[model samples]
Target: MRKNLRVAAYAICVRDDRILLARSPAADGTPEWVLPGGGMEHGEDPYDTVVREVEEETGYHVEVTALLGVNSLRRTFPGRLLRRPTDHHGVRLLYEARIVGGDLRNEVNGSTDLAAWQDLDAVTGLRRIPLVDAGLRLWRERPAGGRVQPP
Candidate 1:
């Protein structure tokens, strides 16, 4: 089996009873709602990655207010590109972010297509990735150890 590892950063921006989210491509290239962030580039800092990804996916400049927690997830699944079973591991840094500027807009020619602010209570009804739930948990709980179970 092949193995894959991904390190990513995400922003949890909540204000006025809503959270910012984007319709991002899932493992199968289908769109699903997710936090406004993605994987880090080679030699890129996670902090910078979160800022850049938030802007790219949501068209908003954000300042990370707090490091919420880290969520590590692992699974074995059939790989789309390899056409074989693979072990995938992901380490995500979730941050509490404050939107400082820019307007809400859909991402063009990128991994995510649509951006929107969903009511906190309404989020449970949306088709979304686990990261969304994990991030929100971290934000609400404010875990002292900065670690959370993968949702």
Candidate 2:
């Protein structure tokens, strides 16, 4: 089995009852709506990662306001050859962010293709990534520990 771990930062930007979201360009045909952020670079702080990723994916400069929470998820799936199983773990940092500059645009030839603001109530009807729900839960509930509580 092969094991991999990824640390990522994501921003939850909401204004006028709408939330900013990016559409993943996954080649596996599982594309879905996600928050505007991605994996951190080497030696990069999660705060910086959120800011940088937001700009890259949404073409908008963001100010990370508050740490919403952290989420950890793991999955095991077949590797390239479908022979070896790969274990993947992701540690994601969720933050509340505000758009400070730039215009809304989709990422070009990147992991994500589209960026848009969707109505908060309409989000439930959209096909979305799990992180979207997790981030929104953190924002709405605001656990004292800055982490999602298992229920």
Candidate 3:
């Protein structure tokens, strides 16, 4: 099996009682909601990655405020492009961000299809990526170590 490791960053942008989210384009199957960010480019700072990704996905210029936390997950799944079962590990840096400028809009010809601000309380009803919940947890209870505490 092929092994793959991905390093990425995500933004947790909340205003009023809503949270910004991006609807990922259907790839593995059903489209899922995700935080507005993606894998880091070669030698790119995670902070820069977050800023660029947010604009690409949500059409919003954002300023990353604080480092929230990190979350990692590993899984085995069939690859979309390679068409083979593969082992994948994803390391994600979550950051608190604020929209500084630009108008809200959906991404075009990107990994994500749409962007929207969802009611925080209504998020539970959406088919979302696990990172959304993990990021929210980190945002709400900021641990000193910048890591999620196991229950």
Best by TM-score: 2
Stretches > 4 Å off in candidate 1: 27-30, 79-84
* Pairs that clash in candidate 1: none
Residue 36 miss distance in model 3 (angstroms): 0.4
Whole-model lDDT per candidate: 0.92, 0.92, 0.93
The local lDDT score (0 to 100) that residue 78 gets in candidate 1 is 72
106 Cα displacement, candidate 1 (Å)? 0.5
Model 3 weakest lDDT span, ten residues long: 23-32
**Tens digits of per-residue lDDT for model 1 on 1-151?**
8889999999999999999999977778877899989899999999999999999998999999999989998999876775879899999999999999999999999988999999999999999998899888999989899877654
In model 3, how large is the Cα lDDT of residue 33? 95
What TM-scores do the predictions have?
Answer: 0.91, 0.94, 0.91
What RMSD does model 3 have? 2.0
RMSD of each: 1.9, 1.6, 2.0
Error of 3 at 144 (Å): 1.3
Estimate the overall C-alpha local distance difference test score of candidate 1.
0.92
For TM-score, candidate 2 versus 3, the one ahead is 2
* Model 1 weakest 10-residue run by lDDT: 77-86
